[model samples]
Target: MTGTAFDLPLEVLRARQNVKWRKYAPDVLPAWVAEMDFSVAYPIRRAIERTVREQDYGYPQRNGQNAELLLAQAFADRMQDRFGWTADPALVQPLADLVQGTFAALWAFADANDGIILQIPAYPPFHSSIAETGRRLVPHRMHSDGSRHTLDTAALEGLVDARTRVILLCNPQNPTGRMFSRAELLEIGRIAIARDLVIVSDEIHADLVYDGRRHIPIASLSPEIAARTVTITSPTKSFNIPGLRCGVMHFGDAALLARFRARVPGHMLGAPGIIGIDATVAAWAESQPWLDRVLVQLHANRARLDAFLAIELPQVKWHQPEATYLGWLDCSALRLPGTAFDFFHNKARIAFSPGEAFDPACKDFVRINFATSTAILDQILDRMATAVRALG
Candidate 1:
């Protein structure tokens, strides 16, 4: 873990967790999973180990003698500091994870029968969760001008109906790393308030932004907006601790909070998410120095990826990201004689989550993970380039 970027091993990564690792030879690089190759930071490991040693594996209590409770409050503070949004510990609800948090937000707006609004080319689970939950799937696709991504605010507003109760939003959006601007969030907040729709703001990637762009948590907008907003954040993505299965949900409205608090127990959510909370507290309260350095490395790796794709692999179209560590690549330029989805699957031997998984409009795109070292990214580019030329 304390080696040069090259010391980050593609073989070790490919060998460890990926299913493809056992099937393929050592030459291939793995970038499919969101999990990182780097070892968990010293502080985070210590926190989890301490929890383990203390026999803290029992079900967590919402507010009674629970470390999760303490950590939930810390996560709120961290969100406030990072996004200029204020929240209270008592108002924060810990879920099994962020995706679960989103579902819980959906439950909060049980009145939304027409379905919740999903921005396409989103995290694929949103679509599945919607169908599984029996809500209508209202697709509000993001418009890409070929260079940047913009939400069709008018289109989203049009999707809202009397039966629609909530809009689930991914900020510092997954797959495509575009961070929503303050202006964008304000417009969205205004629409949600006007339509009386609750906003499930999944800021899971809240901490991973580009150099200049700031993450605008929708809850921080104003009292009314915060009232209707359910803000979810965790150290899972930023700190590379997703296996812990911990995340936070914050609501400012007392009546809404009371309803949530009362129902959460019946829904089996009154239990605390101790691992998530402890790791989050350590991450927010102590891991800033490590995070700062990692950001620098990630930025460099991102730039390195962009330059390689632009020069060596010009046949691939990649939208340069303004935030997040993920790269959204448009592979249509390759024109490998079939749909972009199947091309990478069969020919490339590259296991990228297809563009179709994000949104219908992005059938020609692919979500590329660039959260690893420059060396690994270099290998990925090389493999993609070879796949393109060979398949063509």
Candidate 2:
């Protein structure tokens, strides 16, 4: 409690009822979900407690010292200060979470059966979002050079056609953790612009980039790109407060905002809870020191994971991520009897996200969440090593 929040003991973590801890059996070591095992930032905690104490629980207000307006302004200011991107506070709309924002954008921008291009291996929810909305999922596979992953822009262009209406992008991309460079973003923007497709960029992992890398919002590439983009992001991932249920979607211009509003309507989207709004504002405005500490811990964990794979589990290969805490491990080399996820679960009592969930072709891979304490991570690595060695 006194030092870095990432050092929390497993017993303490298991006592909480979050999905990441509760989803597995007692013997299982879970490294599947995106949420971190770290404690909440002090500022975020204080803000939630203060809101509860004040009995400020009411329908959220839109103006005059209210949570919604404050959150919008904070988001804009944070964007400017952190990424050198100027966002319009007036265009920022609150949502229950990023998934909801994605659903809303798909519904607002595309007709039923319209094609949406998504890069894989992608966040699992993105696949479901498109399917649930009746949109055709055009999978654009990322090019992997056995070590690094890059967007296959040529494949992306080929996927687009008369039916395609949207390009759904995840930056500091999920699972893979590749923070797309500005040049890559420019190419994507070029495709979207040429095809007149709307770009819905999920930037929830924007704050978690490792090393000296910076996350560039695709919408920030130019005025033309911004005019056709909808950026959805939140403080939940960075501040470890996803249970708070707060997120924002920013439309590039007034017309794009109007188009979305016309389809979904403001009331249908429903606002985040007052508690969520307050915590988010606190996260953006007063939690930088806490975030800085977390970044340092994550960087160390990433390096430790890289070393473990090299020395102990060299059969498993991966591209060290540029951002996010997730590690996509290629387990094809292990030649397990079944999927790597099941092998780890049954043999090592460790649960990782099955790669097939992201894409059917990724059955030989599994994604590990490395945002836990050094002890937990070491235990996971040890379990993995033992399981792999048993193959002999």
Candidate 3:
């Protein structure tokens, strides 16, 4: 037992009725979504409770120099404290969530029909954002050797054209779990600078890095790199408050910031919920201890998953993620009748994110959420192993 607040009973988790639990049949173990099975942090919970008790549901106030929003100030402070990045509140804008910020940045930086470069095996919504916004997608596939995933710069160069305007970067990436190194980021910076491209970096999983790996925000590399980057991040991923729906977009260039502000309407995009605001402030300010404990549990759960696969499901090929609670499992060797996702859902009663959802070519893979209680994780693996054994 990790003996942490993250360890919750199945009954309690099911009762919450969040999408992670409610989306599947009660019998199916949900290991799909990014949601963590953890209790709300004490400070965050108290902050929300105080707001609810006081009936404080009003517009969020501007609380920093240059008339910056309160969320922006909180986010800036967090960047400084957590990542050693100096984020100016003036350049930050609060959005409903990371997706909103992504879309906004894509719209602000790229023109209609402009080409946008993305690393493949990416988060699903990223593909949709480009499609919905009428931008051309130039996919740069990352090569994986069952251990580390790296981008092919030659392929990246081949994909770019005169129309390319933005490169959507997911650091500590989603399905592949590649926490890009500073050297890697520098190489990307060189490409972006040469091509005059703006980088919209999704660092939502920045805080979840494990195994002594550090997360460096691409914008923190240098003044020039910072100027060309827009960072989209939130406390929701780190603090388990996605339902609150608050995130921020940090701009390093004044001109880019001005363009975004001009494109987005002030009142049309509703302010973040008061509970979310309060929770976010408390989360960034006072919940580091809770986060530390949650990381401990997550790290242990990851090891348990690694051991389970090595012992029982050797053919499955777990990549052993360096960061995030997500596990990218390669089930191609099993050669089930159907895709790995459907096979698991039918045989083991487990719901994993279909790898094809991340990239069309990843039909043999499945992404699992390991940020769960050890007991639950063991149950999931046991069920999976039993299912696989029965097939033989």
Best by lDDT: 2
lDDT of 2 by residue, 1-392 (tens): 13464567889888888898899998899999888989888888898898688887777664666668888998999999899999999999988878989999999999999999999998999999999999999988987887689888878889999999999999989989999889889999999999999999999999998778888999888999999999999998888999989989999999999999999999998788988988898899899998999999999889999999999989999989999999999999988878989999999999999999999988889999999888888899999999899999
Candidate 3 TM-score to native: 0.96
Query: RMSD to native for every prediction?
Result: 2.9, 1.6, 1.8
Residues 170-268, candidate 3, lDDT per residue (tens digit)? 988998888988888888888888899999999999999898777999999998898899999988888999999888888987876777778775554
The alpha-carbon lDDT assigned to residue 20 of candidate 3 equals 96
Between candidates 1 and 2, the TM-score winner = 2
lDDT of 2 at 340: 87
- Candidate lDDT values, in order: 0.74, 0.91, 0.86
In terms of lDDT, which candidate is stronger, 1 or 3? 3
Ranking by lDDT: 2, 3, 1
What is the per-residue lDDT of model 1 for residues 1-392, given as tens digits with 9 covering 90 to 100? 24453235665765575453444545545455576656666688788898789887777553567676677678777877877778878887777667776666666575445578877788988877687777788888776787887888878888887788778888888877878888888988999889888788888888887776778888888899888888887787788887777777888677777876565552556443676667777888888777777788788888888888888888777777887778888877676566675676566556666787777766778787777776666667777777777865
TM-scores for all predictions: 0.90, 0.97, 0.96
Better of 1 and 2 by lDDT: 2
Q: How accurate is candidate 3 locally (lDDT)?
A: 0.86
